[model samples]
Target chain A: MSNNYNTDGDRMIDCFLNLGELMLRAGAEVNRVEDTIRRIGHAYEFERVEIFTINNMISLTVISNDGRVYTQTRRVSVAAVDLEKVARANELSRQICAHPVPLEEFKARIADIAENTRHYGKRMRYIASVVSATAFTVFFGGNWVEALISGAVSIILVTCMLFSDRLKIRPIIAILVSAFVMTMCVQGVTHFVEAATMDSIIMGNIMLLIPGLALTTSIRDVITGDTVAGLMGICDALLKAFAIAVGCVSAMLIFK
Target chain B: MTYLVQIIAAVFSAIGFSLLFNIHGRKLIITAVGGAITWGVYLIVFTQTENVFLACFVATMAIMAFAEIMARIAKTPVIILLVPMLVPMVPGGDLYRMMTNLVMDNSGQVRFYGHQLVMEVGAIAFGIIVISTAMQLILKMHAHITEQRRARH
Candidate 1:
């Protein structure tokens, strides 16, 4: 156990686990996460690599050149979708595959990503939130006034979301709180606006929180042979959607 | 006129979701166009077929193929392009209506919206499964052929 071989094996396992955790947190699909880890292990010249990954956890095993076996597992935090990070991680994985980097360099790279990852600015995020709510309102048959009002209210909801996200609140509770806040805001605003009804405004904002696309992607995951990953994703999405419904309903009832 | 508005709505909505997803630059334009393409195809097919399921299925397949091609060309993962592009197609209106009916205690309306939601979501899911599986097979077969040629050498 004192030989250099064990140290190298331990480092390799650490690097692979780091890569897997990065990809999972960046919102890469389960298939992509498993595939990237396996590819990286092969590139590093490991004898055997096996990985089982679902949305919340990744477990990996590798056999070294000298018959040393190493395994590591990581719990992924509930990720907020950040495609820029996904692209960066995808690019890093490809770079590693093309030519393996030292364990230190790989670990440094992961830390660099964590520290210096770029994000859309707060101003742009606010604008995007406003525009997204506006367009969705119109898309769902709301008129000009309703769209504008929904857009205005969305910033408040977006702010709430940002706060909850920073606080690291659980997703279900965050969504429930956000939905309740959003419905409450919409109701208060529409009362003065007169022309705009609560339904269209609420519908527009709901687009921001509903997990419709996630639900669809989960089934696709199942079809692609990632049954566990798919089921976990499905349950997570269904729960979030239900939270939104419950929050909205309870809020509406309170005011009625 | 309404169709034109819907298409434009899609483009902006895609842009918004792309921002929320932390995507920036040229890829943003790609998702924007992909959104218009998605709704445009969905409209054309839906009008002709008068079948919601078929409309969603064809629309999703078309845009997914677009996403795959764009990913290859841009050297980005397909999901980056695919998810934002697909965001506009989500049944937000239907989901809202369903919830509304539930609150109003209108069982009949809730059931109607629920069916629509399931059909739309199912069709899109099936579309993604079929096209992605097809793509995977094609890539695997190509790799196998390449290996065989190398072996011969």
Candidate 2:
């Protein structure tokens, strides 16, 4: 029994290392990144696998090997070196293999992300910048109020995630932050435009925030016969569309 | 004459923008050249006949041809060059028009215009994708030949 356990543990570590390499090759493809992460998570037999965007603004969908899926939005920061966090999650997964993990560990994990968000902040900043610029340009037409709103949201998200650097939160937090920041910036821009009745040409530019890449990539992936990868990409694209709508509606409701 | 300036600027801007976006390799030059040709064709056709569709079709063909030439010459990813050049031409304005019309709850002609708007935007995306894909195929064939040559050497 002891020997079997040792061999399994060794295999799990090897699998995770391989997954890390695959992720490096995938570049900025979110589906490829998530798929790689899922491969690692599966090696450990994790019940719930999720990659959070670092901004504490959006929590991506939860993917489980059990074929169950759920999505949520939350502020999760990476506190420090998340190897320990992964180790802890591994332990919980093992415990739950025989019995369900205590809710306390989940709570602690959430708290950890909140506590050490800064180390993850810079990693998140780049993706956020791309997204925000896309959204800002698409929705708002060089309006100061729109700029202020986007700037405020960016600052708030960065400040919130800055606490977790010490905890070494998961790198996936960056993706979440990017998505949220972009959505917020677009919404902010749209609101400012509507308020000021800006020109359509300017407002059109902000539509760059739309995940046209994801949409096209998903189509490509599906055509290329990578169904799992394609599905994840499709899910991401759909979620962003939903998020854009939500942000726009929320801004409308709040501002009005 | 002003159209000529827009064409030159578009081409130069596409190249400059690619550099600004950190896209490197021969594909960038190809994309810039392609954008210039496309712009020129559009200007010429539009000026001569004022036929928007014909001009757009000619521009698309130029872009497609340039993409193929660049991909083969540079031996790099076609998308790296194609996407940036297409950026200026994306039908963002149409999307905005559609959304505004929808928001305003315009019916009849407004609704008809909205549908047209969608088709135009989709056409831009479809055109870019199709042209790039065709270029990618040509590049793949070119790559195969180069591989064969290298093997013989």
Candidate 3:
């Protein structure tokens, strides 16, 4: 490790904070985000690095061996499950740990990563949503006709999600609206086609609404001893589930 | 024949989820296989014991083990594979049923589904903890033995 690299404290702090913000916004778990920040600090020859992360914020302090201290706090409000960006950021941290680079180079690399990685396009996402809903109908033992109905309902749900994303609606509200739309469509279709089983179709399509990622991540966090993060995740999942149920029930009441 | 259909459905569902998560290329197929294995084990266990909780636990263990091994081989985080694969086993249907029962004022059925939901979620959580801890221990032991061998050399 190079001990006297003459690195500016402010630039190092900016780089570290940028990495932390990118990872958190990309939906890396709290523990992983903290660990990455610590590793990055250590790689840059920081004497001590401390990080405290909550559900929506991160605070970090890095102390150089020369007794200079730099502290920064980032407020992260927009968190989506983008594992690809998380993977990219993880790889960047690993690279930083393996080979220390100049601040300018590091900033440029981060910029490139942020720009290059992209989410699946809107059309592909819609197709994936439809496919999962239709496949789940079969998994739930629904017949082919029911699968078709579920897939059609999923198309509407996906469009609603896209529109909600454009309008910057809250996730809870978006989920509720999507669930209501799905149930209403399913019910309307069933009225015309007497053979369509409403229960199976709704049940199958509802898989899209379930917070499986949050539930599993929360359980993993709790088991790993990050009780606070885990609890936050659980509460989020439960609230989303409640919203979905309320939406479905309200739609049923109106349609029935 | 029916089991085959179920397994294929699980595969398709997993692939769809992986795509939604932007998991591309070879990792996508591997994730689908992981899902198939989980659903296959789940069906076998459920059929033999008629116990949903145990079935979910055993299947979760299988998926976790598969994920750990795949993560090691692919050099990717375990979560990339684990999250998409576990989607099939989630009790989404039971949750929907529980809410429906509540709305219908059927307290008995609501309680029934609610209990099942808790047990299923608990069983899966327990399975994850057990497998993850065991894998970490095994990795540590392997590292220690390799260090000893290097010293002897």
Candidate 3 off by > 4 Å: A4-6
lDDT of 3 by residue, A15-84 (tens): 7778888877877778888998899888888999988886678888888888888888888786556778
lDDT by residue for model 3 (B12-118), tens: 89998888887877889899999899999999999999999999999999999999999888877777788889999989989989998998899999999999998
Q: Which wins on DockQ, candidate 2 or candidate 3?
A: 3
Docking class of 1: high
Clashing pairs in 3: none
The interface root mean square deviation of candidate 1 comes to 0.9
DockQ of 1: 0.84
lDDT of each: 0.89, 0.46, 0.87
As a whole number from 0 to 100, the lDDT of residue A17 in candidate 1 is 84
| Candidate 2 docking quality: incorrect, acceptable, medium or high | incorrect
| Model 2 chain A worst lDDT window (10 residues) | A78-87
lDDT of 2 by residue, B12-105 (tens): 4455445434454555566677767766776787788875555555566566567666755665434555555654454444444544454556
Residue A164 lDDT in model 1? 94
Q: Considering DockQ, which of the candidate structures 1 and 3 is the better prediction for this target?
A: 1
Q: Using Cα atoms with residue i matched to residue i, what is each candidate's TM-score against the true structure?
A: 0.95, 0.45, 0.96
